[model samples]
Target: MDLKSYFNQLTTKERELQFGRKAADPLRHAFDVKRVVHAGMNGEMVPPPLAQKTWQDLMHQKVQGHPTQMAYFHIPFCKTKCLYCGFFQNGTDQAAEDAYIKRLIREIEMDAALPRLSGAPIQAVFIGGGTPTSLSPENAGRLLSTIQNCLPLANDYELTLEGRIHDLVPEKMDVWFKNGVNRMSLGVQSFNTEVRRAVGRLDDREEVLRRLQTLSSYNQCSVVIDLMYGLPLQTQEVWQDDVKTLVDSGIDGADLYQLDVFEQSDLHVYIQKGKLPPAATTQEQSAMFSFGKNYLEAQGYKRLSYCHWARNNRERSLYNTQARCGTHLFPFGCGAGGHVDGLSTMLERRLPAYQAAIDQGRKPLMFLMRQSPYAPLAEVIMGQMNQSRLDLQKLIRMEPRLKGLEFLGSLWEEYGLWQDNGYLYQLTEAGQFWQVNMTQTLLESVEHLLGGSSQIHQKKVAAQG
Candidate 1:
């Protein structure tokens, strides 16, 4: 059956859910709510019986052709939990951290000699966490040194240290630079002191700028930060000022994000109970998204991805862009996740299980997934949509059935979300704001069109009604 026939088979309500309910303000009102935090279709999880064998079999073989590759290291310790963060795993304790670092180094060593890892050049290395910067200089140094010694990093590798900016002191800065970290991605969700403190971010606005300046002054790495829109107390005025501050801060790049507050999260509860002001609605965030994009483009900042902007050649944001396109990522540290060959694995997030597994000379796997047959097509959808463009021709060439997806481009274009520029559909400012939604919907539609009916979930997040 053709895609249209498949789509037609769904009930009216399901069609509305899959495509959208058209509205005057399609960018916000077209969908009932944002569907997800990030966009991609689900893959079948590998059962426990086959998980270890899959890992061993994949690791035993050499990577055939050169593919863009990267590594992810998770540091699950944070000194203070930011109210809005979802990745926080554990609080920082000196003794726990010391032991964790030792275990992490051992984990790195375990994979060092494997031909699948050691034989190829790693394009990027991202050390992310509850707060990687929360690590003491000693632990940070130990981790960074081990990475340099263990991974076969590419000569032009982009090593990014991802964490909160509280550790921007000279001590941590020196450790990062000494170990060949060429990039740093710090979370500075807001430059509005009121907004920050309301959400448990310790540093005030002035201190944030000062520390960022300190890091940039080192001139050793591409210093990037994450700024969010639609937080409680982050009014349009405050949001504009945040953008202005970023331009003046002279940092290399930044990701201007629209905040997603889960209903179960502290931020959501606080606002609901009147402890904090309401966050911006989805429509309001759309306006903020347009303003930020326009302002950054006006300032000659390159739009590296939908939300990410680069001030110069310094911030490549390689790992983020490439990982979505099926780069082989070596996961390390507890709570880390990666994909190898066609399998995706998440290491044990629980410290005890992770330590026990590693101590027994086993990969600390929590779950392993075999990528669905649709993954390659989903990757194409995600990678292209992330850059605010989608090449229908590429999809059609990849699989003729994907031509049906073009109808989506047509509909979204009419909604003022995108434009046809010859061979590709370039997302408008509105489309970019709603990229995650569109990407998820399209991925599900692809499955429904080519296979069977699939459920598309619409979630209630902070910005959504």
Candidate 2:
């Protein structure tokens, strides 16, 4: 049977039954796969546990002067629900939004009031969500005002806001620009109309280009456009044009996403019906990603991660590079995560639960992820995976827990996975092809160890539900 038929034959119950169980073995296998691939290329491997410990120590290190500099915010409101989106964003609710924003402001107040956050100048702040720009211009204004009032503002800091092409209209852009938002990331998933329809996004190419041009006119912020490949019917030809359109737009950066289908999304519904284009196989998606990387790099964009590329001279892009050293802060809404001086924390998620607690004057902290060695371990994994390159000595100096350099060296020799310049270690073609395995190894390793078998099953259920 074809992939669609194969997917269809598995009942939700059967799939759910196999969910986390299936991941455990494959995820474990991926590590060895990673080793073999790396070994083949003279890449490296370090035991994850050792890396985790080293990472945690890095996070808790309190040098006399430097402190936490990371912050994150979540705006859970969206103008419309896209079929392919899996983030925790909901359609707009004016009253609920008003309430949530007030709670968010309260949460920020609590964070600012914390002694740990007070003295440290924030190095980076990322405002993300369902669609932050979905807020009415008035609320957007208030939201900006709220952040300014609550945080210790850093003049040279990187401040990013998420927006859509339609939402980047003059009035909304004006509000965002006036408020010191130095960076804007537009959610322009695809320029192909049919592809947009296939994924339930609706920005026309002309409108997308025009809006980006308008954003370019703004002197206050750099612009980053988000593009997606691997939609139901997307071909490499189509995706290359999408990249060309983005390159032609003169934006500062681009985030190239491959379509990911969670069983809960409407995209899954189409998948079930075979009405949508078949999901691109991993091999196909990798090729598309390779195409994008080659095209963007040739156009003068620096690759920041597997999916993010930026012009060499952009400020926010520079901050991303600096953040690789673990100085970035992420203090935002529930579901948003980031690192600061190695510490990790999250605000809260359920709006009502979060708001109700904040209403009673409680800081809306769902949980503070204790600084553990795993924090930096995870960061290295994410950062390296995103950039697809590792500066071995630099990473070791940054966290010092990577005791497996020799092991990595062993794997590199055995598997032919990667090659080294004097300073940087980058993946070979085989290593590049196994990008998903690399990401899965890091993420799934954490998930399994932290939450174990039940948690995986629960996520599977959540995806299905």
Candidate 3:
């Protein structure tokens, strides 16, 4: 169907959501608000009654082809919980970690024996969680050895260990380097000592810089830090210094993140009680995003993704890049989630339950979901949008039905979101700020055009800032 024919089938409300309002500055005030922080399409939540047979028929005994693949190992224990965190599972205890690692290794061995993952070559391995860096040297060694031994790691695999600054000592760093951890992603939300303490970060500014420099002195791994823009005490000037610090720190790459405040959390309570300052409003965050993007580009740092930047070749960030574009990931450890063999699975979260499943010699499956029928196309769109450009020709080649989406390109251009540079639609500064909103609208438009679901109409609400 053509764009006009498709629009003719929808009501005004539906059109407004599917295509955004025609605003002068479509950057900050286009959408009512940003709905989801990490934006992407999802598949079926529950298996349809008839899908069981279809799943069985389509399921393969082995990985289908040489698709890029990765593995995610979750460490669910933290030495201390951050004030703003919602993912904290358990406090650190040596006895608890020892037991968990033993079971985790067992679970790894069991999955390695499965037909789907047995011989597949995983190109990237990410050990992430409450703090993978906080693991004792002994435990870290054992876990790393098991992963290197059991998994079919490719010759040039990138193994990233995520953690905090307090754990960046020589003791942990030595074991990490010895065991093939070539990438270290540390969270340094802000370098201001006052700001760090307000958010429950233990290290002071001096220690953070000293530890980062020490880690880089090893010269054996690529180091990256994460900086958040909308923290409770992170002012505009502070945000500038944080990014400045990232560039000056000589790290390989950085992630410029916007904070999401969850209601009913410790952070929220403290703010309500006047104990902490208010977080940056969404409008302010949009400006912060623009400044970060421009400053990094001016400094000659390459844009690896919408939120990620790289200063050199050492930091390709393979796992995150491939995972976003729909690479298969083998999941392990408590609370880990990954997708493989046409299904996504989340392992059990509770320690006792995870241990029991591992002991039973079965896959510790907490939830399993079949992907959406349009998953392949959705992956391409999301992956491209994240890099601030979309190829319309590729989209048309992927699915002729997507030809109707160019109506959106024409509309967004008028609103100052993107430009048509030959065959590619490149997003401008405004488009990058509102990329999530534009991405979702395009995905929803595609789904509606293809008759995937019924649309709900809303009375068009005028948005102005």
Among the numbered candidates, top lDDT falls to 1
- lDDT of model number 2: 0.62
At residue 341, candidate 2 shows an lDDT of 52
What TM-score would each prediction reach against the true structure? 0.97, 0.76, 0.92
Report the Cα lDDT for residue 436, model 1.
83
Colliding pairs, model 1: none
Specify the poorest-scoring 10-residue window by lDDT in model 1: 456-465
Writing each residue's lDDT as its tens digit, candidate 2 over 1-465 gives: 222233245676543232211222231221222111111001122243454344334434444576546577888888777777877456789998888777777667755665556666776677888888888888888878877777777777788888788887788888888887888888888898888767767677777788788788876787887887777777888888998888887778888875665666788788788787676654466677778877877887777755668774573554455454455664556466555553454556677767776778654545444454455555566567556666667655664544334344334424444567666767654455455444444333443344331221122212221
Ranking by TM-score: 1, 3, 2
Q: How does residue 241 of candidate 1 score in lDDT?
A: 94
Which lDDT tens digits does candidate 3 get at residues 346-445? 8889999999978877567777787777778878888999889999889889898888888888888887889999889999888888787778777767
Candidate 3 residue spans exceeding 4 A from truth: 1-18, 45-60, 452-465
Best by TM-score: 1
Cα-based lDDT for every prediction: 0.86, 0.62, 0.82
Error of 3 at 402 (Å): 1.3
Clashes of each: 0, 34, 0
Q: Which 10-residue window of candidate 2 scores lowest in summed lDDT?
A: 34-43
